[model samples]
Target: MSKTPKYFIVEAGALPEIFLKVAEAKRMLETGEVDTVHLATKRAGISRSAFYKYKDAVRPFNDMLQGRIVTFQILLKDEPGVLSSVLNIFARSGGNILTINQAIPANGCAAVTIGAETSGLEVSMEELLSRALSVEGVVRCEILAG
Candidate 1:
């Protein structure tokens, strides 16, 4: 059986410089700033082999998730200020909240679905999710779609 692919959210400072260079090279090519991978790699100050090695695996967070609308489903303890705290987290993270649909509290919990535009977010989606999860009374949080 084939194993599922695993991914990690790492800070930019922790990654090798070559990965950033490869992402830049790919962007240059996509935006027509460079005509070929050869020139793009040279301009990015990386070797062709290095660029090829990481091109598929390394991507800027903005390139992957920015300008997209994402929906998050959250399970929260039904208590005063719980939803407010979650919304505050999203706002502080730079996500633009578009809409929210919350269900009535039942069995001491409530389900809420939030839609947000991510273009202006200062942090990666993973970080945003982590922050949301860290909020008090948040039982669970997940990206339903994007």
Candidate 2:
């Protein structure tokens, strides 16, 4: 049986530069910045072989989750100011909050569901999630829907 592929959220700084180049080339092609993969790779400063090697494996987070209503399920520690700190992450990242529903604290944790419009995000979805996960009270944060 074929195992499902695993996914990871890696910081751009931690990734090889070639991956960024491939993403840039893909974006250039999609946006009409370049007419072909050859030109895209050339402009992005990566070899065509390098682009082809990683193209299918890398997609920009902004492209994957941009311009849509994204719903996030966040698990937070039941503590004062935890929710506010999480919401501030969204605000600072340009996520426009559309709705939020919080379940009562249970087992010293709270589950919060947030729906936000992501068209205006100043950072990538990956960056936004990383920031959320970095918060002191955030136990988990993930996209529930989009």
Q: What C-alpha RMSD separates each model from the true structure?
A: 6.1, 4.8
Give candidate 2 misplaced runs (Cα > 4 Å).
1-22, 28-37, 43-61
**Lowest lDDT 10-residue stretch of candidate 1:** 56-65
* TM-score list, all predictions: 0.65, 0.70
Tens digit of per-residue lDDT, candidate 1, span 20-84: 88988999999899899999999999999998888889987657678999999999999899999
Q: Candidate 2 lDDT, tens digit per residue, 71-100?
A: 999999999999999999999999999999
TM match of model 2 to true structure: 0.70
User: What is candidate 1's CA lDDT for residue 99?
Assistant: 99
